[model samples]
Target chain A: MPKGPGEKRQWQFLERMLLIRRFEETVVKMATDGHFRGHYHLYIGQEGTGVPAIAALKRKDFLATTHRNHGHILARGADPGAGLAEILGRATGLNGGRGGTIHLCEPKLGFLSTSGVVGGCISLAVGGGYACAQRRDGSVTMALFGDGALEEGVSYEALNIAALWHLPVIFMCENNSAGAMGMAKGGYPSLVHASKNLLLIPKSMGIKSVRVDGVDAAAVHAATTRAISLCRSGRGPVFIEAMTPRWAGSDPLWPELATGITDLRMATGGAVPTGKHQAWFEHYDPVLRLARELANGGEESVHRLSALDEATRKRIADAADFALASPLPAPETALNHVFVQEASA
Target chain B: MSKQSYAAALVDALHDAMRSDPRVSIIGGYVLGLGPQRTLTDRLKQDFPDRVFDPPTSEAGNAAVGVGASMAGMRPFVDLGTASFSYLAWSQLTNEAAVAHYMTNGRLTAPVTFHMLHGVRGGGAAQHSQSPHAMLWNAPGLEIVAPSTAADAYGLIRTALASPNPTMLVSHAKLLGIETEVSEKKSAIPFGVADIKRRGRDVTVVATSLMVPYCLTAAEALAKDGIEVELVDPRTLVPLDEKTIIESVSRTGRLVVVDECPLRGGIASEIAATVAERGFKHLKAPIVRVTRPDTPVPFSLPLENFVTPDPEKIAAAVRGALKAG
Candidate 1:
């Protein structure tokens, strides 16, 4: 049975992508339901950039992302329940509840960390890459950020250092046109932010750069594979501008934060909110489009993909349950883990 | 033990650390020629080419990457040029690196030693002159250390390299050239332990960094006046050796703090407060602090000298603490 519409491996890839979508969908619900608190940036629409691009990375390879990090975490194989538990500030979470949505990390799994600040994780990626080069770990570090990060001077510094050292890093920019703040109500055509092309900037720095349609998971995987190969062979520190679109249409949480709870129902209960941009998101939606492609492989491929979505949905439900049931960190342990907390056994 | 300049001691430690562990390295704007026309790091750079890094000019980026390297199992001595430049990387330093271990629940630890030269070095005024030890002292996760002697600079830096937590060492620019006998052999100077340089019963003078030597000088001059001043150097500020300071105060029943940092919210203030809280009953007089005024360091030598706490100021504070109450 073929996994995705194209390659047999792609179906599993699609499953991972859909699972991330399911996870993000669940996160929005949980965040709204009061299971999670504090400022949260959902990795909803930009799943294409995180999943396939991060999926290409192995266990030893480090993956760093921005505040919108769930997709990157899960695509790197972070347990859905544990991630949710962390977001819910549970003692059993990845960061033992100290790190909420913005700072999820599982170093053992090569997902070093996520930074709330824009372009913050870039230097970490460079540093990780530098360490890997020193150790000759035969591993790579990929830094994923948005077009918004390009505006940050530190991002350029990170890129320049990466290029100067030829560090084994893939600078992946998920170009959602505008960030969570500058979401064009229409689409990229209507996006007003005068964002510079990420490719041209890196190219000017003599860094090997590439661009690919991020919505196509297979395309993303193919491009990332080439980039990683270059990094592995030592002619590296590549820049990849994946034209990834965010289906969020508009800032979901801000409106809820502004209008109170009345606007929550539009996105809840799996209701597809009405709008031209929403329709565009639906048509261009990676999952739906991938399913449409899988439909070419007859009903069986489509069924398998749907089954993946359903199983992932169920898995996300269990994650929510785990998040809700897990205990908040003990009050007495507030000062714990400031330094590497040694094993108590 | 051979006498070493503060510069030589730092280089000796860096060489020892890099030689001892392959993971030990230095990252900064320029490690070579860090002081005067020549530097200890410049020598280390020639020796361990890969370990010593001259990164592009970006304090925030350099700090982030340095911390990242630390997390990736390297003991990186990240020097952010002058102490004032730390202001540029304040966000990353305080928020990201300092809080990393606590925030990540100890799954990740950055053993990065951030080095910055503080205090007013003559013409090095305003932007160049800033004693940020006070700033780093208040940050909980970051262990703060300021070495007045060449031995401690060598010993403490090595200790910081070995530490699992983030550490910031603020070396006074003036102390770098001062020659002093270090350990005969390699030694690790543990943090949170005060070194009692001179013992006297008249009054206990607590000091830090450059002020330690100034306090010692003050003690000598005051001793001529038949005023015996016991001086204490709380080498590390964060894991402050409050016990030693308190015990010293308990013995003397009087306290005066000499600090190169500002008067308000400086290490002296903290020391004064600590002695007051823990050893108030032991006090025979009010705590006095000889510190720079809470203002930007001026460029002119006269103005700078006036603001900076010197032997005269330290001696005056001792007399004040003894005479009052």
Candidate 2:
């Protein structure tokens, strides 16, 4: 099954990517089936950025994410059952049912916060950087946000502070709009901003900034590795803008599986790309692209990938069942965590 | 016991907290704003240079830094300068810091103490003169401490620093010079405990922050006119000592809530509502509120005074409540 020297790393990346993909798909299915309420953003096409970027972080490094945070959390190795339970407001959820979809975070896993406020995580991560600086333990903080977050006033303030303080933070902006949005039809665009280039926003503060292809996992991993090393050396607060085309499902105000469920076989010879989503399958889909890369090792590699996909599907299915079976938080326990209680004698 | 100025007690509290815990750190420029208090903070900075930070004047961003630092095991003391300027940080303080513990369902804690100088101070105009504690009280999961004495300031600031929840330490510029006997042996006072500044039986005067001093003067004046006033200073707003206030009202059968906020939807309104809701039978007369008028504090001295509550206003409110029923 292992053809190349780095085949293990390749399979690991593919497995994490598949986990995020199927977890988000299950989220959509559960939402459609009336298991949860409220609007939720999907991290479908941007898996390449989150998986690779997070993989580069050390165990001590802190991370803060935005509304499109499900992929980032899963990439950090959070339990899917707990994540889905949190979305369902169950007592066994990650946050004990308090922080649902948008705020699904695990502080134990070095997550500072998952802010529902557009650019809120950016500023919070700066504080995390300050904490790392105080500890002087070689830890860094990463702020994972979308292009729309750059339009917020707090972003400028946070970026300027990070630069002045030389705080160890990596500002990763995932630009899924890909410059094709705001056209005559077919797509929704990022919020309008005067800056022609989002990178300039951080560059203006004298911050070291770079741009990368969001669909290329290797490129993102390289950029994040370099950024983390720089931050750990105290020459930090780097900015990376990863560009990806908006997923067709993310076009409407609410997320819809416009491409249907991703067909991994389309990467192998068994299936063929067709219809309006042909361009997405060919280039933009990070999961399929990685699958196709692994399948390039011939028939044995394809069989291994197929088995991996089936196991991943089963795991997500079990997570969905666990979330569905988990009980909702007790009505009287709403006031439990409002204030931190002192331990009893 | 030694005489300590309100400002000195506050500075000492911060020093004690930093010395007691390695994780306690201070953030902001000129903690108490530009004044003699700056000298005290300058000393603090010299003592703990590594623990103190003077960030740019991004109120919301700085407050968020405190929230973020707290989440990372640092107990941050963030100063928002003036209560008016705190409006800029309302979102960070209310949305992020205050909600961190509750939203995370005990998985996280933001033990941040936000300090601000609130209330009217002479000719400080509309933007400079504001008491936003009432508005802040509306947001759940935040501990609001408004100490009325040098001793209370020394005691409450320590408790605020030690709290596991986000806390707001509301101070007053006008009360800085006021001196009271503060014992060095006193420990951190627990929250949700009310202090009776003066004992009387005719009316219960509930005051906060600078209003406590004004109400003290009013109580003295009323005592001379054959009326006794019992004064209750609720140290913390979020975990309010309703029992103390209600018991005082039960004895006096009259309540006069004096606060520096606007009359409409102010701290006085909330206290009055609480009394009416739970202590209705104890109140023999309708409750009266002595507060700043619902208007932008004018720049002119007389116009500002006309809207601000003072000793005369508190005394008048007590007399009015006494005669109401």
Candidate achieving the largest TM-score = 2
**Quality class of the docking in candidate 2, CAPRI style:** medium
| Window of ten residues with lowest summed lDDT in model 1 chain A | A258-267
Which stretches in model 1 have alpha-carbon errors above 4 Å?
A: A1-6, A178-195, A253-278, A341-345, B29-34
- How do the residues A223-319 of candidate 2 rate in per-residue lDDT, one tens digit apiece? 9999999999999989999998888888876778989988899888789999999999989999999899989889988998899999999999999
Once model 2 is optimally superposed onto the true structure by TM-score, how far is the C-alpha of residue A10 displaced, in angstroms? 2.4
Scored against the true structure, residue A45 in model 2 reaches a CA lDDT of 95
Q: List per-prediction Cα lDDT, in the order shown.
A: 0.78, 0.89
Give the 10-residue window scoring lowest on summed lDDT in candidate 1 chain B.
B29-38
User: Looking at candidate 1, what is the lDDT of residue B188?
Assistant: 82
lDDT of 1 by residue, B115-143 (tens): 88888987987998998878777776888
